[model samples]
Structures are given as C-alpha cells and as structure tokens.
Target: MTLVTDPTAPRIAIVGATGAVGNTLIELIEQRGLRYRDIQLVASARSAGTELSVDGVAYPVHAVEEFDFAGVDLAFFSAGTEASEQWVPRATAAGAVVIDNTIAFRMDPDTPLVVPQVNAHLLDARPRSGVIANPNCSTIPLVRLLDGVERRYGVRQAVVSTYQAASGLGHPGVEELREASRATLDHPEEVYPGKEFSPSLAFNVIPKIDRFLDSGFTLEEQKMLQESRKILGLPHLDVTTTCVRVPVVNGHSEAVWIETQGVVDRAELVELLAALPEVTVHDRRSPHEFPTPATIDDPYRVHVGRVRVNPNNPRAFWLWLVADNLTIGAALNAVQIAEELIARGTL
Candidate 1:
C-alpha cells in the first residue's frame, strides 16, 4: 500500500472517461478542487483521441489497451463490467489502487465493496485484491442513509422500490429517451423500440431494471439487497427491492420502508437523519415539501424526505430519497474512497 505524502501529487487515471459516470468524476474533481499532480483519461478504442476538458484544460483520451498505469496512484474505473473484468487486474498490477464502479468484482469476497459515507473504515486496511468496488448506483445513497438508522434502531428488514433515472443506463439511455419521445410525438400510433429500455421510456416507466433473476428480482434490485447487507454488516437482514426505470434523466429516487427491531420515535428519527453527513432532511407535509427527482439541488447530498411511521406496524417507517445517480451514486463515492485511503495512508 502507498500513500501520497504530498496529497496533491498523486497520479490519477479515469477509465471510461467518455462515459457519463467518468465525465461526472472529472466534473466532481474540478468542482471539489481535488488536485492531482497528473490526471489521465482512458477509454475504449473507439472513444480514443477524444478531448475532455477539466478545469479549462483539455486532456486527450487514451485507449485503455494502450494506457500505461505506471505512476498512477489511483485509477477510477467506471467502464462497464466487461471492460473492468479485462483491465482492473492489469491496472492494479501496474501499482495503481483501482476503485471500480462496476458489478464485476463487487460481490467477490476479496474485493471490499464500499460507500464512503457508510463504510469508509474499510479503507483503513488495504484491499488484498488491490481493488475496491463502488456499489450499484442505487445502493450507495440507500445504504448511506440507512447506516445510522441501522446502527441505532437495528433494522430488521427493508422494502425498497427504486425510481431510477434513464441516465442509470448511461449516456445512451438519455439519448434513447429523447429520441423515443420525439418519435412517439411524431408517430403516436407506431411502436418505437427503445435502445436501452425494454419499452419506450419517453412517457412511461419500466418496472424492471437489469435482467430478471430466477427469483423474479432484477439484478439491480438484488444489488440493493446484497450490497446493503455487505455495507451495513447485516447478513441476516431481510431486504426486498423492485427497481424501476423512470422517464427522468438524472436523479434516482427510492421509496423505502424500513422495519426496526426496537421502537423509534418520529422526532428522534428526523433529528437523527438531519445529523447524518451528506443527508438532507425535508420532511414536512403542510407545505408539501419533500424530495423529488426533479427538485434535487445538491447532487452530493442524499435528499431524504416524507418521513412517516407505518400505520400498519409500530416498528415500521417510510421515507423517500433522491440523489444524482451520476455523482453521489457513482463518481463522488468512488473518489471519496480514494481520498479516505490517502488520508489513512493505505492506498
């Protein structure tokens, strides 16, 4: 394990720089004033030679196959699972700490799947595999907000339904939505096949996300269940999820109902949520104030609202949460893990 003694001089690489999550990583670096001595952009061969601007300077994108990982203190991988499977080991072998934002190694016992706000302590010890996994886009915020509650009241079970954005599928999903909407308005009677969505996502919501497993749960929903348990260290915690892709283009929202093992006061829960870092509370009914996909202002903070106790069960409660799927859900959390590693001198 290596740490950047200078803090500002670590060489950083962004794999899949042309993709939405990778682009957001660059944006967050610039916005948060994260300084790296050298920053390299690597993408697929087809996107090679593309220039991505960072802090007013344009960096030429290199093909992952050709990019040398030497001197790269950390590599942020947002490439798809296939690309990660191919390049992650090579990057790690070249002495770079790989923070992978793919599902390929997330479930692997050797890879520490992390959401910095929740389980950043995992970074105190170096990963034996030289890789850390960024959990699914929906899993990050959900686990972050649930961390304190689980710690305090002991979460017995969680029932979550995600209203995922089209952007969750990447840049192609965004384009597909726009194209499908235009095609639908122009030819309302004809059937338009969406590229990333099963049905057209223009004016509709797809209840399925990722492929359905044999248990009737989509991979995305399973991710929320499995990843949450891993992050929260709740192996026996019962969890169920239904992941839906909505018509929106950026923010991902979740409607979560959590059953606690012990009694929890509503006021105390509100106060508890407000105290959590990177979590905003807007639970109010008179003004109809609550988090919505269209109303998320801070991309970094997980906006939590509409907190209420379940009428049917004394131990159960409901809440709504939304966050930028590209930022907090993916890039920001990935980078934060790297930062934690650096701070702990364990990268």
Candidate 2:
C-alpha cells in the first residue's frame, strides 16, 4: 500500500458540486476549517462553468469528464450511482481516495460501508479497492445511535419507520414538493405526475419510498436493513423497515423499536446516549421535548429521545432519532473519512 506523508495537505475534489448534498459538503469542509492544498468542484456538463462561492471566494464547476484527477489526494463523490460507477475508478487509479456517497459500491465487499462515529476503525483497515461507501441517509443516523446499544446488549431484531424529507430525492424533488404546495393553495390540479408519488406529498405523507421489490419491501427499506447489518457486522440480524416520504424539507427522522438479547435500563440508556460523541439525547417529556426534524437541520449530531421499554416486549425498547440527512447522512461522513485518512497518516 502507498502512503503520503504528513504536513502536506491533500488536494480534494468534490463530484456533483452543484447538487444539494454537494453544496452542503463544501460548507462543512470550510466550517470545519479543514486544510486542503487545493479543492476542485466537478459537476455534469450541463452545470459546467457554474460558480459556487465559499467564504467569499468563487470556484468554477468543471465538467466531470474533462476534469483531470492526477494531483487529487481525495475525491468526495455525491453524484448518482451511474456517475460514481463510471468515474470513481478513474479517480482511484489516479491515486485519489474516493469516498462515495451513492449506493453504487455500498454492498461491494471490496468497499467499506462506513459511518465515522460508529465505524471509524473501518477506515484504519487496509484500503478496500481504493473506495469507501457512505450508507444511505436514513441508515447512517439509525446505525450511529443504535451502535452503542447493540454493542452493550446484543440486538436481535429491529423495526424502523422513516420520516424522510424532500431533500433525500435531491433538488428537483424539493422543488416539486414546494411547487405542488403552492399550486394546491392557489388551485386544485396535480402539480407533479402520479408516477413521482402515489399520493400527493403536499400536506400528505406517503408510506412508500423507492420502488418496491419482489420481497415485499421498498428499495429504501431494504437498504436500511442490509446496510445496518453490514455496518453492525451482523449479517443474520432480523431487520424490518417502512420508509416514508414526508413534506419536511430537510432532516430525516425515525421511530425505531429494537429487541435485545439482555435487559436494557431506560435511564442508563439515556445517560449513555447523552455521553456519546455526536449524539444528543433529549428525553424530557414535561415540556414535551424531543428530537424533531425542524430542530436538527444542518447539524452533525443525531438526536435521540423517547427512550423507553416496550410495554409488551420484555427485552424490547423504543426510541426516536433525527439528524440532517444531507450533513450527518452524506457530506459530513465523507469529510470525516478524509479527516480520518489524514489523522492516520494514510493520505
């Protein structure tokens, strides 16, 4: 394995710079005060020559196909799966570590699916085909909050229902939802086709997320199950999920129930979560406080609340978790991967 020395900041590249998560990634990179000798933003040909401003400085978005990756030390890819499949290898071959945010390489054994707070050690292991995969937006926060509980008392099964925002589908979905709401208020006609959603998302909640599979689960639900197992290193864990699309603009929330092998005390669980780094526990019910999508927007911390033992199941508990999908879910995880590489002197 080849390693780059310390004190020399790496050259970083962000694919799909104009996209929602891509823009958030750049904001985080600057906010964290990360030191990179050079930063390059790449997008599709249609968005080429676009200028994105960071800290009052403008950077031009280049065409991905024509951008050279020769000197790039790391590439943060937030583009779709097809683009990642086509360009990640090219960047890797040019000696850049690729932290991919799409679903393309997630299930690949050669790629490490990671959430930094939960599995930072995964990055310490040998580089897997020069690529690392970030888990789905909903899955990332779920696993991070549940990891400690799973470690202390083994988790046998889980049931999750996701309240996803319009941002999960990118800018067009957000625009559609916003436009649909406006049109509905003014008049009564479908703003977007029924193909986009079975029911109107404006002032409505759709229980289905992504296309359904033969196994009677939507692709988004399956991703949560499969990715959770992989990240927790429990291949046979029984996980069931129902992913929903809500009218919220940002942040993803989940109501999770888990059955554990041993008893888990509610108070102790609350204390543990509060002490965990990057996790905030808000269990106060007197004032009716809890983790809400509106409150957790743009934050890296995953907030947990409503922790209690299930009334029916003796060894089961219920919890609520929320986080900014674009940050903690995608871009922040990618940035942490790069930070990990630098801290470990692997770059």
Candidate 3:
C-alpha cells in the first residue's frame, strides 16, 4: 500500500460534517492518518462555526455555500439527496471529484456507483460524470461479500432480509430508538411524539424500512437489489430483498440466500469467503458462535457466518452477514474511492 504524500496531496472536503456518517468520515480520516494537503468540513448554516478536532488540530465547520471548491481535489457528500443534488454539481463544476453518499447519483447512468473493495477499478476508470456515488448501507456490504461468489459461480438469483439499525435514519432516529427503548423499560404509555417507527422499535422489528414502492418492496430493498446488480455489472441478475428496521443502534445485519449456476458446497463457500480481503468468515458450529451485531460493531471487515447449502436447492446457499453501517457501509467506502482516485492519478 503506497501512500500518496506529494506536496499536491489532494485538498479534500467533507460535506455534512455534523451528521452521523460525516462524523464517522472525520474519525476515519484521523484514525487512518490519511495524508491530505488540506481538509475542509462543510455543513448546513446552523452548524457553521462549530469546531471539530482531529489529531489535536481543531478545524471549524464552515457553511456549505461559503466554502469554495476551487482547488479541492475530492469532496465527499454525506448530506441528504437534496443537498447533494444542489451542491454536488457545483463542486464538480469547480473541478472536484465528488463521492456522494446520498442516493442522488447512485442510479444515474453517468455516475459510477462503487464499493471500493468490490468495484474499485470502476473508480480508476474515471467516471464519465465527475461525481461517483456510494451504494446504500444495506447494499455496500452485501455486494462486497458476494462479488467474488457472483463472478466465480454465476449468481442467478438472491433473496435478502435486512436487520437494519436505527442509525440509518441519522441522529434523530437514534434518539428516537434510545428514548423508545427507555420508555418501554419504564412502562410508559407513549414513547415518542407519534410512532417513531412503523411499530415499537424497542424489543420489536418493523418489517418496513424505507417507503414502499409500486413493486411492494421498500425503497431500501429495491436499492439493494438494483444497486447490487449495477455494481456487479450483472444486469440480468434476479434479486429480491426485504428491509426491516431493528432496535440496534449501529451495525446492519442480513440473512441472505443466493442461487448460483453451479452446485456449491458449504465448505467451498466458506473457503472462498475467508480468502477474500476485508471479509471475515466465522462459521464455527461446535459452540454455535456466528457473526452478530455485538461482535462486529465498529469493525471495517464484513463478517459472514451460518454458511449452509439449501436443502431444497443444491445450487443455492444461505448465510448471515454483518457490517458497521456507518463505516464500511458509507464513510469508508467514500474514503476508499478517494484513495483509488489518487492512486490512479485520476484526482
């Protein structure tokens, strides 16, 4: 891993610095000791002048409008779609390569939706559009772990059920979950203003995640299906998913079933997953230990377990996968995009 340290080290800007994903992005930059000549933190007007410290250095968060992107080599947009839609083009027009975390550009034909460990070379190819999009939290880890399998055995179809955390909705959602849990514990009649979730998130699961689409799947489920295909470059792939919101605060977990063109055994699948970089296979059976949210919190690697051949279909198998939603699912993916761009001399 050659680190770029030229005097021209890219001037990077992080949009939505006050939000959950944006905060994690800042932490990753400091934790990894990323070498950048300059760093700019941009947030909405309300968060302006707020100070965020990294490695003992304090940086002030500036209002997005006042932050000039003239020389910024890379800008990460973690703000919502409306913000990304409004500012991403402006930043790109100013000659900055934008890696957006919002859905604003993920499905856009011109923008490459990338998960670095899986389709990083796509980033090296220099997108036709200046902006590159990161897939949704549910889609990122799923695609990363399945990329090799899909390519080697030819995935024909998939069915996924997600156990998403409250943090996926950002700060307010986290607060709602926490308050709801406390209220339930205290035997309160009402927890939130209205139902914070479709059902009581405390000690419960809401079968719906994002808004329902015409196809009867939530927007999040559709994103996982469509984006997974796009990222893998498998247009004809058959995929179905059910996204559910859980009370967990951070990590996202999923139970996935995949059908392949050829017969694949559990041992072979385990070997393939274990060998892949940035993936951890924990398929122990003696004590019944497997990847769980409590075990995978804050980790960068995607954890896989319960690898088993489907009883009904010899060509299909099932597994459990977990990953930190804020990091590998969003911020780290953006960072990897920036690193790839720099390595390929595209930034």
Question: Which ranges of candidate 1 are over 4 A from the true structure?
Answer: 1-8, 284-287
- What digit string (tens of lDDT, one per residue) describes model 2 on residues 154-235? 8989999999998998897788888788877887765545435557788889998988999989999999999999998889
* Per-residue lDDT of candidate 1, residues 248-313 (tens digit): 989999999999988888888888988899888987332257988888778889999888887778
lDDT (CA) for every model shown?
Answer: 0.87, 0.85, 0.85
Candidate 1: give the clashing pairs: none
Error of 3 at 128 (Å): 2.4
lDDT of 3: 0.85
**Could you tell me how far off, in angstroms, the CA of residue 59 lies in candidate 3 after the best superposition?**
0.6
TM-score of 1: 0.96
* Backbone clash count, each prediction separately: 0, 0, 0
Summarize candidate 3's per-residue lDDT along 143-210 as a digit string, tens digits.
88778888678898888999999989888788888888888878867645435585778878889986
Specify the poorest-scoring 10-residue window by lDDT in model 1: 1-10
In model 3, the runs with Cα more than 4 Å from the true position are 1-5, 194-196, 284-287
